[model samples]
Target: MKEKDGISECPEQQVILYVEKEDGKYEAMQTGSYISANYLDDYFLKRGTLEKALGEKIARGEINAIEYYMILEDLTISELAARAGIMKWTVRRHLKPGNFSNISESALKKYSIVFNITVKEIVTRQSGNRN
Candidate 1:
């Protein structure tokens, strides 16, 4: 949208939007949330519940880092595989703790890139872990 035509969502929430300059380069612009405050609050509440439940599962070792990050990022197995440059089946395998042991260092690095985390963090991070 044009700068003047930008939407006003939540006055309290700030978001980043890219606007095209006259020179054709996109620039970062600060904008409001896409949704209203009440909707954003509801979304945050639901996401918080999901995070808490997922964190508990992770703490119980029911799911590993790959699955945790993938779920939090809202990525499908196919999307994750493509982002990490792995096969769909391989991504699925690594989602479990047992099969994660078979993954290589290079693959770990790729996951780190995809998750925007460190390899050490992936292996050692606990539930509710955030930087």
Candidate 2:
């Protein structure tokens, strides 16, 4: 892959991983979450770590630079809604900022199970700036 800056440009065949951000940093994330890359700072707690890692990788040319692509592989709202057995509107509501707070633990658990990803990955804490 062609490296640029410090972000990986995922290949067409590769799935774009989603990470959560909290408190102005990047956090790990589980699948099926609605967090968007555009709001990475808001949902991710480990931005420093991610940036550092990507920077090193970019310097070595191990991966391409990061850029947003129109295509993504993560589940859509409708797909998540189907798995949750809820209406699409419910999924949309859960993805909303204020509405996300209302999602029940049980619902989150079910979503995690269906997506086969860990809650920790979904909600990662920010790592310290030790690099």
lDDT tens per residue, model 1, 1-131: 56645556676888888877667787877878777644877888989998777777777778776787889899999999999999998888888855666889999999999999998887765424421
Residue-wise lDDT of candidate 2 within 22-126, one digit each (tens)? 454544433322234344566355655666675454344443221000001246667767876767876666655334336677766666565565544333211
Give residue 77's lDDT in candidate 1 (0 to 100). Answer: 94
Q: Which ten residues in a row have the lowest lDDT in candidate 2?
A: 64-73
lDDT of each: 0.79, 0.44
The TM-scores, one per candidate, come to 0.66, 0.37
Query: What is the alpha-carbon lDDT of model 2 when measured against the actual structure?
Result: 0.44
Best by TM-score: 1
Deviation (Å) of 83 in candidate 1: 0.6
Clash count, candidate 2: 19
Q: Alpha-carbon error at 38 in model 2, in Å?
A: 29
